[model samples]
Target: MGADRVGGVRRPVRAVAYAASGVLLLAGCASMPDSGDLRDVESTPRQDSQLRVFAMPPREDAPPAEIVQGFLEALTSDDPQYATARQYLTGTASGHWRPEQSTTVLAGGPDIQVDRTTGHDSGDDYAFTLTGTKVARVDAQQSYTPMVGGYSQPVHLTRDKKSGQWRIDVLPQGVVMGQSDFQRNYTSVNKYYFASDTWANSVTSATAVADPVFVRRRVDAMTQVVRSLLSGPTRWLESAVSSSFPAGTALRRGVASLAPDDQNRLTVPLNGKASGVGREKCREMATQLLFTLQNLTPTVDTVTLQRTDGGTLCSLKEDQTETVATRGSVKQPDYLYFVDDKRRLVRIADGGTAAVAEPVPGALGEGVQKLSAAAVSWDEHTAAGVGYDGKSLFVGSLVAGGALDAPVLVSQGKAEGDRLTAPSWDARGDLWVADRDPARPRLVLLEQGEGEPLDVRVPGLKGRVDAVRVAADGVRIALVVKAENGSKSLLIGRIERDEKAGDRPVVSVLELRSAAPELEDVTAMSWAGDSRLVVAGREEGGVQTMRYVQVDGSTPEGPPPAALTGVQSIAATEDEQLPLVAYSSEDGIVQLPSGAQWQKVTKDGLAPVYPG
Candidate 1:
């Protein structure tokens, strides 16, 4: 969410001022207008009242495309010249650099090549898709200065009628880089999953990808329904994450259902006429995430359910069973998932590492908060995770905020190199998890008031446990283990608890198996239904994801018989419908309603979420 002032994006006081601080996004997919027919298009009508505040027609003098090009040239100009660009500027106080910010705008012949241009943002904004091709002029040799990894994709630009002139409002390329880098930097931002393609060099970064190109596609698609909210046809600047999905992909419509198993696991699905490629892509990404991410290596493991006595967590405990894990790769809690009755997340935040993203204004405001406490901190690594018990709600996130009112415990485990990798919750009040810090040794179990004696020494679980989840009805348990080379894997099976292990239970693990594909830094887990589960995991080098669904639809099989791809973190409604999976990578939550259609639920941006 942007802020309290955020609404379907209203108009501006000045043409240029309208976009002040209004992010200019580009996914390297430059969709600009062709030079021929720039002025003929008409502005789209506004849907929401506020979005049309500064709504006005473009000056009769200049074409929409021409106005946008003016700003584009000013940005790349070698010599200082704000003349054309200033004409189209909104002229508001903002962070957007002005002509004065430039020493000289490049003039004469430059490296900009217009590719494709079209009526964008509900026809209210004209756009151009151009490439900053490093073309060698007759007198000069040209070499491409790689953007990010390399090969700058086309840039998408948007033009709007701010007042007398058509002002450039959105920059798809700039927005693309800005948002992607922001996400990459946070390293903590997590989402359900999305489906996709691999036409070229790009791995497509797993699923469909939220790059600029993908975002614009979503924006345009959104216009089909809410045509009025955009007086200027609201531009899809950067982040694909939005509060709502295009009406076509919304979850509230019908067909799909949600179910929660005894262990508090959730299940839901998207049904209808979804393309095989799309579903397949989503599954592929999910599979990668579930099968990878956690650097799990186990020595001794087991799954067992214990009845509770009284407190928030069950009185049961695990005696030393598996060898202590080496290290669990849980960087953020959101990466990990657990089946819950309501699917309550402590706080849903948007952030990334400072190394990549721009400074998040009071980043604290964007994260998950339980009991009304805001947990946001860039000084340390953060994780977003959920805890469900069919009844109670206990969601946890790695924020600098401490509930007990103590100094925020920065990642103590990580700083000392005793990296606390994966972290997750279980069906009951208990959480199947493991975080680490040197001075502290052994695989320990924890909750707010749980007694110390109940904490068990999971044998073979030497260093740490990356990610862990208890299966349906608490019949099975899954854990990501780290091994000698630091390689991680999933260890799933049955566990038996011992009362003699001192009020707590001694542990026994049976039928342990590793995921088909090895995982690196395991994240989260949710129940799919009919006995299957969807786990969210991330590999060291690959994209984040959720995969692995149950087959028999009755038992928690633990590790899956095969690896699933293009999916991450399952939040199904149980056995009824397929599942309502959160596809963060694709910038929304997807579902299979009834084998007939697909629904995408998102919260990328809306008004600011005023904290409690």
Candidate 2:
């Protein structure tokens, strides 16, 4: 046998020595055998190259156990509308079943144990229990939340008198499948909304925030995503974001499909609730739709929102999208700043090839005060730096002759290791930093980089916050927390603000959850996109590596970035087009440009960062 090359991989090929016999068999392959009783030959059920799954219906007079097993297999298959799965259920049960309500993912396939006490031979009714370890869940809003614990459910069946066939009369709500099956059936998508806090300040530049959710990959994905978006943000994000669609807004009744036209324009038909919005507000709605859909289907060049009456309410093109809501990707950074060997702030052109680094403007760059770490404002107009001793935090302008202001915030931690972290700026111009004082550790927020720092309350935090980075959307914050055992973990929390009549608004971080549960030590992390982060960490008894993880606790497609050694600090921007910069002990500061290997930017630089 000779070897064959498939998709660049070589594999052994079996050879048939009977050349004449093989030729005859191939020629007569279409002919069927004669003089034999005809019977249906079922093809093997399997998934094809396109990832489409096929399932067969239950055989006639199948046992109760087989019926339950067949139904569970059908749930994992990509049967559009899940028509075959309903065949295993009774008439009433099928009508009431709502598979789209939610999905329960188990660690592995469920274990079915027949209840012996039910006495299978005594009557037509049969009972069985399904048990497995719980993994996570995807709610109706398509939000995925990681969970831990056991799962147990009961299923009851009865034989129909007319056909004498067993069918399920009682079943669990929604669908339950193993973790591997869930990953194959669903894909993550980001829904867009406007930041409520940014809009509340009457700011002209509106920032678009991403609300990530999961949707079926092969089952009318376009329509499903549009409907999810119209349903408003998820429960966890409802307080921090606002939707442009009016209350009670939804897709027009009887609308079953949505797609783009030849010119790549998508026209969405909404119910009467959205028909009366003003022109300005309608444009805002279209902008949200445009950004959300573009992420799913990049070919969609424009979006025209239509009212129930089929009249155009508003239309927005790809180029005009930024005018309504600004995204981090739309803003390009000018320079990549880092701390040099002398503990001074310096920067190089963001995309330049030269290795030369120049001192930044202002006193911090003039070597007036040595710095250990620094964060640049999103606007690139101001910079915040932590002093070498890590006891003081300084803010200054990035212009010539700009005086270094006195420490706007200071830490009283006796040890240098237990001090302030590098500062981060949100889209609203608010600064965020964590004070690691053992006596009084707290997360603080400074409004517009001035005024007294407010103690941001974290309701469920159990460990000390070692680092902090606020998303550009200004509503989500990522923290690296160190537990009492000295192990570090990455968590994503929601930032909520409550405004008062005459006093500053109250801020609190709520609903904290693990973003990297598998990693035992997270050394550095940065917001790489709207709802994605680039993390550098390692598992227990493993070496360090860098990977991308979704804020929802799901791993994104593709392998992790090229591995680097001794990474002390890592930096990335919301705009993924820019190269990634990291400070490594072996290579100093290096940049990984798109499609290229790591290149040294400087010999003795650390704490590399892009604006925000």
Candidate 3:
């Protein structure tokens, strides 16, 4: 047996997992007797305090896990030089292990956590061993970031008998982490992933799918990501999963099946205890996959949709693919239309499909499949994610500009299989899109009568345009572009003043650099105001937040995505301070000010039409 097996036997040893089922509650298994006696106690101690501090030849009373965590936090602490490896060690980690080569190293955030800590002794020598869990976000995965498992080795230090203080005892030549992590630490984002499952259950209560087996598969897939080992392999697997199961593998497999919403033992507990137990053994490690963004060409096609009411939503005669033909009937997994409650199609995309699922054991009803056949058209080329209209309904691509039969222009040119995320419009009737057909993915003004874009050019931009935001007055356009070497730049230009760069509006902010330890969030830019640029993202929530950074270098902290979740259908409010008004894809519209509270507009009995 290995030391891991022996160590697990004497103390609380968690199951070595790389994954489980629906409502999969993650639990640790211990080799220690009466492992059931353990509870999440307040006295469990902050793992950091257990560090074995280093002194003189280097040694102190502490656990290596805590020490290593501390070192990781400190090394990445921000010095401009610390942007790369050699710079960090020269300024931080260089005191010990010095690397002879100059290199550029990439690091993801908050993946490793010391789950259970203990001390190991070998005769005259002693060390602190930390058995923890870690997950990594690498480019290798099927999705954005696939969760996996990891292990940290024992760190060294001598017991300090004289002074009660635990000082730095020893470091392994050099540590693997930096200083910033220590300065800012919070695992709240990690906590929220599981919580999202609960929220998903609640929100989707009315609309239920009856498949259980397929649900189990998805749940297991998530377990694989969550319990995956932290490494490059896991990253590759995430991309694969995200590509293969764009509908969210975890959401599909975990909830409806293992812990079906049905009134059985699974739903009875609600807390997921039953669900977690049943799926523990079903943990699935990530399956490796390799893909890249290849399909950037827009293939246009026109198809008529059959709304649930059996009414002709529209002739559907539109799309750049052809002159606009109409399909008499709609089919499954073709197009997904995000419609308002009143059935106004706001956003629509093709190519992506829903996950396959199986009915739960004894959960199938005598009534049979009650769900209506989705009438929207989708295929396997584009994934147009809809934007939620916080006030009235969700903006779907199918109904933008009140034209169900509007010409569908498929801006095709994205990595094959990569979910080139597109925006769902708000109640404002605008679809934010990036297309290469115009030779610029930069912001283009899309309107009912506008034959072509008015040539909205951002001031002094130098590369492929990733995103564009328009102001309330339609004057400002904010864009983000990735410079070589993973550096992000924020560019804000006057759009209304000069939609076409012919007349350059006062270039407010040319370039605002990021101080983030990880540049993942600011890689693409979105417009928050006519002049103020919002640097943020979705998916990786905890690491990024909504903040106001202007072209003039003045900034203030802003609301989190969760907080702004209430403010949908965001449109520039025009007021410098009151920057945006969010239209609800559901009920009412929300007005957003720079520091103002969100306002609603539902007095006028405006009904929403959900996009099919």
Scored by lDDT, the top model is 2
lDDT per residue for candidate 3 within 416-464, as digits (tens), equals: 2111123322112333444433233544433321234333444555655
Show where candidate 1 strays beyond 4 Å. 1-411, 415-428, 438-443, 447-449, 461-463, 507-511, 515-525, 535-568, 576-578, 586-598, 605-612
Q: What is the C-alpha RMSD of each candidate to the true structure, in Å?
A: 24.7, 8.2, 24.4
Model 2, 411-461: lDDT tens per residue? 999999899998898877889999999999999999988789999989989
- Candidate 3 TM-score versus the reference: 0.28
Query: Residue 232 lDDT in model 3?
Result: 22
Please provide TM-scores, in order, for all candidate models, with all chains considered together. Answer: 0.30, 0.90, 0.28
Q: What order do candidates take by TM-score, descending? A: 2, 1, 3
Where does candidate 2 clash, by residue pair? none
Per-residue accuracy of model 1 over 394-465 as CA lDDT, tens digit each: 223334443322212223343523533223332223333444445553333443213341344454554355
The local distance difference test score of model 2 is: 0.82
lDDT of each: 0.30, 0.82, 0.27
Regions of candidate 3 where Cα sits further than 4 Å from its true position: 1-558, 561-568, 572-578, 585-587, 601-612
Clashes of each: 182, 0, 122
What TM-score number comes out for model 2? Answer: 0.90
Error of 2 at 212 (Å): 0.7
